[model samples]
Target: MTSAASPHLTGGPETLVICGRVDADRAELTPRGELVHGCADILARALAGLPATVARVDLDMAGVHFMDTAGLQFLDVLADHGRRRSLTVTATNWNGQPRRILELAGLDTTDPLTGLAVTDPLAAAPPTAPASSAVALERAECLHVLQEEVEQLRQAIASRPVIDQARGILMATHGCTSDEAWHILRETSQLSNTKLRDVAAAVTASAEADGPPPSPELRTALHRAVARRRRGTGKAT
Candidate 1:
């Protein structure tokens, strides 16, 4: 059962598709689609804001089971967009009904191991599979989606240890508590238009080099957050 509604998480706002940590140049999107038949427009809208670079877009379609004409058409459209933008759009881990559909549309979604193109659809007939086969495939799709979520959760939690170290460093340097340090991290993330994990990673890296915030940009953003908070409260006694 593919759900278009957002997936509720504990901390922040819910993200429907759980896109892999998108940086400036690349994005990995794993759409949890049981049947990607009629929702091309919704998917397209979700993928619109590509960073102004030749994005290496990797579409992980392991979770999709069924794909109709509309789904294949969307892939073609995405391929065209990639060519126009000099991007490399590749969809991988396709099998069963979805793979058959893509093959008919002339989109080469080949095997994971060999990187060799699977059999030509025109050269051979599509295989006839049983209902149990589909059920098994659906199960596999669910497992793949679950694994994706698990990996995302792991990355989300992995940031905390480093962020804690950064918080301690900030507390010692600025005479602030853990909460105030977190405020600085959140504010810097907001002001610099960067993810909190990235900010934490930078701070950790800086500590390795025996320095403050790794970059001047980070330094500036950190101080700006403190300044803004101070201004709101007036002069501190």
Candidate 2:
């Protein structure tokens, strides 16, 4: 049954159509001065309502322009849920900012357009059908294995947005390259006795509430840092 208000509806037998945004605002700019975080909430709520008989989910993200860690978390959750139901979830309109964010989070759209199976490079192998006598056991085992892998993939994918957001924040505040920002985050997390994930989460949350921007000072510092790094590399060579 489908409701007009809801962007997602469970169709008969084997399909689901989810259309909406997962973000709070549409015009918010990224550290790089681009709009982001659009239409994530709509997507999240839709994915949260997976039906048991669904074999495929078509996600329309064309209207989404900006997405944050929360949006990424929703995707991971949906991917995991679809896996448990043996459903394939294909995302459409993932180019531009949405595509960049997904790629940074390790959820490549070109992979398989499915669930956790896409995340697991090794899960493509065909499963052997069990003997009729032990069919129940086989089903249980398959479910269990798929669940474990899904959970792991979900966790990994969830972490990506946090990390990327943190990197973005660092780039804006510290005027560092993406790589340098990541390194700072890693080093700071190590020195502060915090998990890298925790640090990333803090940065993202802080940014949402209000934080620094990619100011001119930061850009200057970043340029200097890049130049220094280049010079060092040249010297070594």
Residue-pair clashes per prediction, in order, are 0, 13
TM-score per model over all chains = 0.37, 0.34
Q: lDDT per model, in order? A: 0.61, 0.52
lDDT of 1: 0.61
Candidate 2's C-alpha runs over 4 A off are 7-44, 48-51, 111-115, 118-237
lDDT of 1 by residue, 88-163 (tens): 6777788776676544444466732122222333523335557658755864564455445445655877887988
Best by lDDT: 1
Which lDDT value does model 1 have at 34?
44
The candidate that achieves the highest TM-score relative to the unseen native structure: 1
Worst 10 residues of 1 by lDDT: 7-16
> Candidate 1 regions off by >4 Å?
1-20, 35-37, 111-237
